[model samples]
Target: MHNDTGELVAALDIGGTKIAGALVDGAGRLLARARRATPADGDAATVMGAVAEVLGELLADGRRPRVRAVGIGSAGPVNAAEGTVSPVNVPGWRGFPLVAEVGRLTAGLPVVLVGDGVAMTAAEHWQGAARGRANALCLVVSTGVGGGLVLSGRLHPGPTGNAGHIGHISVDLDGDLCPCGARGCVERIASGPNIARRALETGWRPGPDGDASAAAVAAAARAGDRAALASFARAAQALAAGIAATATLVEIEVAVIGGGVAGAGEVLFAPLRERLRDYATLSFASGVEVLPARLGSDAGLVGAAAAAADACGLWETAGPGGRRH
Candidate 1:
């Protein structure tokens, strides 16, 4: 549906691999967009420069004037209250003031910040698989496993904006130590890189292309590679444990899985669904549904806009000079 409110928000999705920007409307449509490869090894300023470049593209668009606010979805842990982010994968961005910098770049527009997982949840709840669900968990299982919750039909980002970060929750006590100082965390097992690592350790060789990504492993799994299938199965078990734990704690109605690894289709979902039954045995949790994300690559950008629109009351209350009331 078209947004009759004429509300437009600029959105930024910052990850370890890329920086994406878009001008999104209230109806979850992208009016303009831009992206740049993240210089993951660069200093703080250099990383910020890439963000600036993406924003420059949006700013140059003819629709720029109608933009009412800015939204940022950055890899966590993010301090939404303080507008700072310390994403685990982006080492150079410890405690970076992303909101302030984006606000300055956007000429003082109101800027709202949320963890990338929270942003994805907002988008899913607004326009994707979780839209009609009153309680849900949305997960991104790519370079990392990030998640956010929606409860009572609203995004629940917690005080620090990292409420539903299930990636660090220990699923195995004796498992390998995660970078977050935890052992057997979901990300350590279920993340794409970890999936590839496990497949390689178990003697799953990549094809002639030498692409050892989780996608390649998934292809091998589809081709009946035992080692590749085992790796994905292990990842699925970890994911199922995490999802069941979350469902048991929150009574979520559904778990929406997304991101690069999720693109593996049945290679991930078939085992995930089967394993979920093993863990989610409680009556309430057993009824929980698992589904793939529908928003695809645009989820982060759309979610960032959804978060800003929700937080700033863009649809209902506008203060002087188009600022949120």
Candidate 2:
């Protein structure tokens, strides 16, 4: 990492609900950061406009410094070879030429494309919860459920940059339908909106504020609300079964949970671990440790910057978009 010379890299985390930008150092430390709300309609042009606006504001700051590269992590079925992303929640960006477009915004600066879940894994491994760990899974449960893995110290983006997407892993062949047309995908069962939906179905309505988010569910659970607690328990079980399956196949050493749903803390994790223990078919998988993410909200931005810096040879350490090592 010494060769990085502490140059700033622009890191962008484009989620379904919001877009955030940061100037991060070679070490994945944010020098400056900004966030903008994404339009509920989620149009791709509008989303890109928001991204450009945030980047412009970042550049306009008097303290903005020379940039080395740009890194982006978005919801996706990314075409790694093309640096493209197709985030599911942002219906506007299917097959979107993300890397090319972002590169244009950056005036052709070198850019690295990554899935948002994978980006968080990169960030977590670079300097957050998964730091110093050789192999781990970083799962982000928010508007959607997503994940990326670091195995034996390498970032494994799979063939298409959507390697570690545990959300779409079907746990129940007859379970709920996923937007991806799959059955019982963990995302369908555990994501924030879905969790809130479950709470609503269970007769635990958050007031008419339409603020019935996963956080509200967690709050109610903490207050000993039976319906909220039961919903989270099911979500945890579904998520854990998926993680256990991944660990069984790939031998992940740890699973670091993050995002808004994970903010529920033990309400989400305790039962997840218990369920994994109950459902794991292999002995090695039973030992996989689950932990809270350490990076707070900046994991994506820092992870994106980390990926960019590493790809540009600013750092030698590989990030979370690849193998778990």
Candidate 3:
């Protein structure tokens, strides 16, 4: 970055469930972080306010470094050129001017926009599981299933910034309808909501105290719960099918999968591999390797910082030599 003292930046991961923010250095190190419930706030303005609040907190802490810009990894479908986002999961948000809002908070400091999945891939590729790999895919299987692609060692977010939507790929024509109104989508079969649907159909209670999250179901399966185990198996099958399709189409070398739903561990991965083997139609597709993501919560922060650093260009600050200052 800048010798031993790098420039600082604010980063945000705006997902359907929560909004996470962090102050990070040019080296992609998180200096401070905080999160708040996204659903508690209903509209786009409120959500932006929530992000502003976190950024405000980071700035209020005088001990932190000199922050420069703010970067956001928001849920898709976003217009990167215009800096607007309209995520399907968050209907309250419709073409919100992301850069403008964040810029106002940062005193016209640059703001960068990116898809959450794309940001995850950047984080993983830069510092976690996908590091050093040129062609790879990252899929997050949480409230929904989303994917990001890294091709030729660079992030490929596509024109409208909604590419690598692996979950929307249909595996069965007669499968359940998705929120997008499309039939037989992989997410309709394997995402958290669908997994819980599969469980409830088989008479599995999610418990009054706990939500029917993938984490809860995985814990139950590990404890020899039949319905929960079956739900995971079904989800794994869909996951493998989706993985095979992505591999065949993009020829990605490896796939990194994460999110709260992936906590099923081998309970989820083993069957996914086995199912993948069952579905592979050729040798090329069969070569794709699937693994778990290693960045955990930091993926979003690191990626958001990368987006900002990439945008600011002033992030690393050019040194006398060609190297980072």
Best-performing candidate as measured by TM-score: 1
Evaluate candidate 2 by giving its C-alpha RMSD to the native, one decimal.
Answer: 3.0
lDDT of 2 by residue, 137-240 (tens): 99999888889988878777677677899999998889988888989999999999888899889899785675788899998898989999999998998898
Stretches of candidate 3 off by over 4 Å are 1-5, 39-41, 60-68, 206-211, 311-325
lDDT of 1 by residue, 1-325 (tens): 3347687999999988899999998778898989999998989999999999999999896887888889899888899989898877779999899888988888899998989998998888888998778889999999999999988777888987898998998999999999998899999999999999999999999999999999999999999999999999999999999999999999999999999999999999999999999999999999999999999889999999988887877752111122232
Per-residue lDDT over 1-325 for candidate 3, one digit per residue giving the tens place of the 0 to 100 score: 3435557878888887888888887666788888887763478778777877877887788834477677788887778788898877778788888778888877877788888887887677767787777788899888788888877766677875556778889987888778788998888988887888888789777767867777778878888889998999999999888888888888888889987788779879988888988876688888888889998877888887776665566444222222242
* CA lDDT for candidate 2: 0.82
Off by over 4 Å in 1: 1-3, 316-325
lDDT of each: 0.90, 0.82, 0.79
Candidate 2, residue 142: Cα displacement in angstroms equals: 1.1
Off by over 4 Å in 2: 1-4, 39-46, 60-65, 207-211, 319-325
TM-score of 1: 0.93
Residue 85, candidate 1: Cα error in Å is: 1.6
TM-score of each: 0.93, 0.89, 0.87
What's each prediction's clash count? Answer: 0, 17, 2
Cα RMSD to the true fold for all candidates: 3.9, 3.0, 3.8
